[model samples]
Target: MLSSYLTLAAILFCIGLYGTLAKRNAIIVLLSLELMLNAVNLNLIAFSKYGAIPSLTGQLFSIFTITVAAAEAAIAVAILIALFRARGTVLVDAFNRMRR
Candidate 1:
């Protein structure tokens, strides 16, 4: 059971990583980041449930991760909105010109 959960989490993480690295859209990138975070959370929960010590530490950490992910999403969305307003585009490649 633990192995299955870990396998699923691994698959999810890979998909999220691919989406984050390959997507052109900022929104999709942010969503992919969230997906990656969720995969981490899933792993944490699974370990918490299956570990020999059997404490709540993993779950507690997962909760904290979720809180951080929520805050990150909110901040990312705000930045994306501002960026879109300024440039009329949400493509990652377009952001490169901002360095100049």
Candidate 2:
């Protein structure tokens, strides 16, 4: 069961990584990043459930990770919105310049 969970997480992480690296849209990239984070959370939960001397530490860490991911998404979206307003585009490649 743990192996299955780990396999699934690995697949998700790979897909997320590909999206992050291959997509041109900033939104897609952000979504991919979230997916990757979720995979990490899954692995943590799986290990917590299956590891010797199973404990809640992994779950606690997963919760913390989720909180951080939420904050990151909110801030990233805000920044992307501002950038779109200024640059009229959300392409990751077009964001090379930090300032006009």
lDDT of 1 by residue, 3-95 (tens): 999999999999999999999999999999999999999999999999777779999999999999999999999999999999999999999
The candidate maximizing lDDT is: 2
lDDT for each residue of candidate 2 in 1-100, tens digit (9 for 90 to 100): 8899999999999999999999999999999999999999999999999977689999999999999999999999999999999999999899888676
Residue 50 deviation, candidate 2, in Å? 0.5
Clashing pairs in 2: none
The lowest-lDDT stretch of 10 consecutive residues in candidate 2 is: 91-100
TM-score of 2: 0.94
Q: Please report how far candidate 1 places residue 73 from its true position, in Å.
A: 0.3
